[model samples]
Target: MFLPPRWLQKDSFPEATTFLAAELSDQFLKLLQEVGPQSNEAILVPASQSLALRSQLRTELSRPDDFSPLVLEGMLMTTVAQAGRSLSRRHHGKPPAWLSRAKELLQDFAGAPPSIEEIAHSAGVHPAHLSREFRRQFGCTPGEYGRQIRIQQAKLHLTKTRWPLSQISLQSGFSDQAHFSRTFKRYTGSTPLEYRRSFTSQ
Candidate 1:
């Protein structure tokens, strides 16, 4: 998708390609401000991931349910979020004990995670220090690590249980299904239903 700073239109759509477009929400625009301004660019979608999304989108379009719009929005937001994260770099080094402790705190949250300040306090450091070192050693912010863990748990639930999306979201430390769907897609490039279908279709 061409973001700001550029515009183009195809006179003839490619038979082999499927194009999906979404309007950026006000909330997502605000998030872009924090991620920093990015020039219009192309992101290559992996074949398998693209196939899964296309299949799911077709199903949702044909069957239109309460969750269809929400899932599509989550997928779009996921794309933007991943683009921002792609600009980050991971540094390799031994992690300090306190940073390890902070990571442990993030993984151990059973429900919604504690604030970064709270984790920093538990790890015996200031929030800024924790944020910096965590990214330095781990390559992602503290919140991102927490999200990874939550997404991991959600994946397990998607594969191992018959639980509905809402139940899995609640049990996997998300505030609600929408939050869970958005974060899950941000990391996995697929929504919960799409991910589950991948396992079941095989």
Candidate 2:
């Protein structure tokens, strides 16, 4: 991952009075405000259909990070909202604690597959919020991420053990061999038996 800039020193808070996750966009607003205090600058943006604000934000998400993928994505979106609020003083970013909660929720939820409500509670957000942004940050929804994680674990078991397919499926979180066979083929284009053979033959 790329190193963060000097501007992002997390410890430089209250004492030095830096930005909170909620205030990130606010700080940017301050920057814009300081440029002329009361004058508005013509910020040219390409996303003309939906609020140009969201388009501008999508652009800032290209930055890399030390946070896990989901956390990084939330942080990126937060940064965008901050940029938008800074430019126009719209001020609509999630609370820093909420974003942190979402990260922890992502970690906790993945430890075992979780219900949408369980995940949302862990993250301190509504189920709808969890479902919506979870997909935005990850290409798949939370449930899909869990399913893929389970499937990948199944792959590991299939390659590393001569265990029977039923046992492998059970151990790796599948409901049954039939379910495992379907998922395995979807992921790798081969049956479990064929996958085991490839690994064993090698």
Candidate 3:
């Protein structure tokens, strides 16, 4: 079901297979455009729930009289929403080679991320240019992304181990437990203790 831009004009289906196709209706296309411009080519994301949704869709299609349009539309929209989210995380157009390298460096040094200048040097670009393009492409500054990565690591330790806040903070690149608590709260809308308590209680 991959469709390129203007696919209706360029592609044709055999009569037997026509029933298998679904048009990107104007209403749905408008909804997608509101999120962001639809990519010229479709982007696919491997989601765990997709198989379940597809199975449900098939079951509904088998009994057309019992099928609910609302449920069908929900399934279609969910798949589109997941793809849109994945696309937003990538560059608008084709990504530059350096962008991947820069992301790799960020993950490699998540515990102690490099400075903007250092990252630019590593990626073979000027600092100002890297900052501009990185933000434009990834939708966040490199430092912000690095902080998110650190916080995610800290969250894992918080849930999986009984480590004290101080130790988790140091290990996850925060200056102290207080700083970690504030940052974690800002990002997740829950303090470290609150987050862990919710998970443990569950």
TM-score for all models, in order of appearance: 0.55, 0.47, 0.58
Encode model 2's per-residue lDDT on 169-189: one tens digit a residue. 888777788988988776554
lDDT of 3 by residue, 1-202 (tens): 4354575645332222223445556777776767754557574433233446667888888776644877787777777766665566573577688877887789878455689899899899999999888766765678877887888898899899999999999999988899999999776657899888877876
**Alpha-carbon RMSD to native, per candidate:** 12.0, 15.9, 13.8
Q: How does candidate 3 fare on TM-score? A: 0.58
Q: In angstroms, how far off is 119's CA in candidate 1?
A: 1.1
Backbone clash total for model 3 is 0
- In terms of lDDT, model 1 sits at 0.72
lDDT of 2 at 53: 36
Best by lDDT: 3
Best by TM-score: 3
**Lowest-sum lDDT 10-residue window in model 3:** 11-20
The TM-score of candidate 2 is: 0.47
